[model samples]
Target: MTKTAIIAGTGVLPGILADRLDETNTPYVIAELEGFAMENPKGRPVERFIVERLALLFDRFDDLGVEQVIFAGAVSRPAIDPERIDPKTATLLPVLLPAFQQGDDALLRAVIALFEDAGFSVVGVDSVAPELVPGEGVLTTAQPSQDDKADADRAAKVVAGIGALDVGQGAVVAQGLCLAIETLPGTAAMLRWVAEVAKTCRANPNGAKGVFFKAPKPGQERRIDLPAIGPDTVVQADAADLAGIVIEAGGVMLLDPEATIAEANSRGLFIWARTP
Candidate 1:
């Protein structure tokens, strides 16, 4: 039997992929890289391995007849210790450490290359679960006001330009004032900081505060680490006193899309999937 596995990290993407696999009755396993992956795969084989222990995991997958792999969810470059990994994996660490040190794109490309070098095909989640990609449009009834539209447009250009520098994928543009940009600290922190700043120097109190633009890095590989947001995203935006969010159409992951849209609607925040 041809075998495949979902290499789950930490987030809702893995579960979403798992559900899609189930609908097609596709048999597969879950390779849970330690320190990641939220919940255990309830109905399938779940093998655990530390992220640095690649050699052993590759051997294990080969033994289990696995031929394809899909990576989903979020993971940071953990501090790796040479003493902890098996000698076989240690030798290969030199090939990987640099990518980990680079940025998300380099690291992701390295991961895919590593798996392919191990004789396993690396595929994007879209290949296995196409339903998750959102169609292009404002996802909710709350539309961006003209000012908000201009801000969103500016944010999109700014983020895209910065993305080429491998800095980040999101930015906050409030009243033509570029408030914050995503950094190594990530989006939630970026938004939270914006909220704090807004509290100290508030907006007009009636005019739209700002909007966040998230999208794929210009000329970067897709499939891994597509921008993601959830219901709590609405809460964060509301707390930040922001106008809305704009994501690259078909480039962002909507975790629990229905609930997320509903939350955004209830909060009167615009959650749009626009062309980037």
Candidate 2:
């Protein structure tokens, strides 16, 4: 019975993972990062830590007999405080400081390496909760029109292009016009901005609204920071007046599949898990 540590961050996914661990009666501890609040800790024992003292946290995990670690939920880059950098973390500053400039994928990879180098096996969300990744197909009764499909194709390519540069995991395309790309502000903000733009834009005269596409970055370290959507995403897309949502099959996580699909169906928006 090896113990595992859940490095919980902000969002429902961390809470959902906590629920799964509880149901299985798994031996685990939740480590909440500083700055990002953990959602619904489920009354579980949680330890708060900061990036400046990761080495100290590792020692704590060691004392707790934790052998594996899983990163779950959303986290933005924390503003580092030079005065608080522990001696151990300071030793690695040469390697970490450059990663901070190299984009998120690089930064995450570097962080994962730190955990792995510390002898803790890093596990992916897919490995811990396979149920969150839906199978391929349109999950809604409203099928995507040919035009909608075309828009999805365009959106997919756009997401891939941006992903290659570690730019974003999502893109919104309407009639082949890229409406928005997900950035540091995240998908919710991007969708809201698209909705604002749609009010004054009449670029899509063919009547096909658009598609919201999401996927993991090309060659991304899937063990952390995989793109995800939930019922809230469906509501946001509906607000943006988009035709539907598209995700890369096996590459994206649906936070609450039943509720997400039901929302899409209720709003007449299709959730397509397409193989790419």
Candidate 3:
């Protein structure tokens, strides 16, 4: 019997991967990371301490004879108060602390090392859900206006440059000015911040409200959190009156691609997936 374990990070990716594993008659166990939320507001996710979760995750894998581990979903890097770490996580803290504070890749690489050292083969979600990847084209029915396209192109360059520096994936741009950059608060919060700025800008004589672009890191770990967009993104952009959304082709994951495109079309929001 083929067995696998999904160490869930965040969002719908993990559950989707589990469904795929189920179809193949492979038994899989889910180990949800602490402090990450599912895409669905109504969904309840199992959360546990990192080390405790990893121990149980491996134990389940051992019990089920799981040979493959799909690292699907987003894991937020929170400011860990060393005093609060559990016994299991505390033991790993001395090493994990320095790498984690360095940057996203450094921390993730350490996480992968810890798992691989314990004999788990971690795989990317792309192996199971190719359809989720976007192609190079206008993803939404509403094609970008000339101005929207130019804005998107410019914004993409900005975000991509920021990504190369390991800063963040998303940026808010309007009228050639970058309004905000994504940080620990994440995309939705970034969008909301842009909306607030747009609201304020509405009163100004200049039409300077900005749209958003999300891209991948220069040499991103695909198995980890790839830039993600979905129906909620459309709703947020529409409600905020954002000009458009730009993402890297084959670099970002559109959760429920068809539905997201449909929502974008209905809301008259432009979505561009650009390629090299």
lDDT of each: 0.83, 0.88, 0.73
Could you tell me how far off, in angstroms, the CA of residue 155 lies in candidate 1 after the best superposition? 0.3
Q: Give me the runs in candidate 3 sitting further than 4 Å from their true place.
A: 34-49, 52-56, 78-95, 199-210
Which clashing pairs does model 1 show? 9-37
Candidate 2: the clashing residue pairs are none
**Superior by TM-score: candidate 1 or candidate 2:** 2
The alpha-carbon deviation from the true structure for residue 206 of candidate 3, after best TM-score superposition, in angstroms, is 8.5
Lowest lDDT 10-residue stretch of candidate 1: 198-207
lDDT per residue as tens, model 2, 1-276 = 668899989888888887887778888999999889877745667899998888899999999999999999888888889999999988778877889888888999999988998899999888778989877888889899998889889988998899998889999988778889998889999999988875245374657888899999899988999889999999999999988999999989999999999999999999999998
Specify the highest-lDDT model's number: 2
lDDT of 1 at 176: 76
TM-score (C-alpha) between model 1 and the true structure: 0.92
TM-score per candidate: 0.92, 0.95, 0.82
Better of 2 and 3 by TM-score: 2
**On residues 80-171, what C-alpha lDDT tens digit does candidate 1 reach at each position?**
87678888888777779888878789988888888899999888777887656686888898998899888888899899888999999999
What are the runs in model 1 whose C-alpha is more than 4 Å off? 41-45, 199-205
List all candidate RMSDs to the true structure: 2.1, 1.5, 3.6
